[model samples]
Target: MSEGRPRLNTEMVRLGGLIKQAEQALITAKTIALKQFDLTVPQYAALFVLGTTPEASAAQLARACLVTPQTMATVITNLEAKGLVDRSTSPMHRRLRETRLTDTAIPVLEGADRAAVQIEEALAVEFSPEELRSLQELLNRTITALHQLG
Candidate 1:
């Protein structure tokens, strides 16, 4: 509020920093949670996607993760070596292979979910429920708009 000075919203700048901190915190939590299962961040992402879309192809997963199909192939290869995922002919398309979470992966996914919940809870002390929900919705809209631009 100074004369001849540009105005800036302090809240926006603080929120940006919060977003970066949140990303780092979540990644750290994921690393710790997945250590016992020997999964990397990308491997966990692939498993989470496969668990949600049990018949997704590696190509689709690559798109979701914003990585090359070749990169996804390597991630899948690692997951397969760990027995966390299984690949087979898609029931919808015989020529296309579908990837899915294996039975063992279900428990791992559950543990990841629990870890995420714990992270959120630990961060919850900083924000009210309504504020958290509003932040979540805002981020979802931002992501949706970004994807729509592409």
Candidate 2:
């Protein structure tokens, strides 16, 4: 159609742009969320994953955070240097370093969580409950379809 030129008005193309733009905005808000703790958004994400998974490898954490292993390594190194997290050889996989949060990180993560919630609440104030539910359902279906495609 139209000499094979790309069209931005297509449903999928518009949906992809919306998702990307939302993610970028969320990342910015999360960065502000963790700024008080002197942590970057990725660092906060890694810490949260480590806190939950306890002794997770950087690669696994990277996959969970949707970042490259190389980028995750740098985030892990930074967390380790700050004494917010520690890494040791995994019992089952000796080569992989298992990482977890330190005692100090819990409080910081809690504060960051609150900040993130505030941002989320502010964003959600404009949407009705039904709209939010519908939006989430559509997003889940889209994600499932993309996963199947991949």
TM-score versus the correct structure, for each prediction: 0.71, 0.88
Tens-place lDDT digits, model 2, residues 33-149: 779989998898888787689889888999998899999999999988988998899889778888989998899888877887898899888789999898889989999999999
lDDT of each: 0.82, 0.87
Error in Å for residue 98 of model 1: 1.0
| Tens digits of per-residue lDDT for model 1, 1-150 | 679998886656675577789788878877887787677777878878887777889999999877899999999999888888888997778899998898999998778667656766887777888998898899999778868988
Worst 10 residues of 2 by lDDT: 7-16
Residue 9 local lDDT, model 1 = 67
TM-score, structure 2 vs. true: 0.88
Q: Which runs in model 2 stand beyond 4 Å of their true positions?
A: 1-13
Give the Å error, residue 126, model 2: 2.0
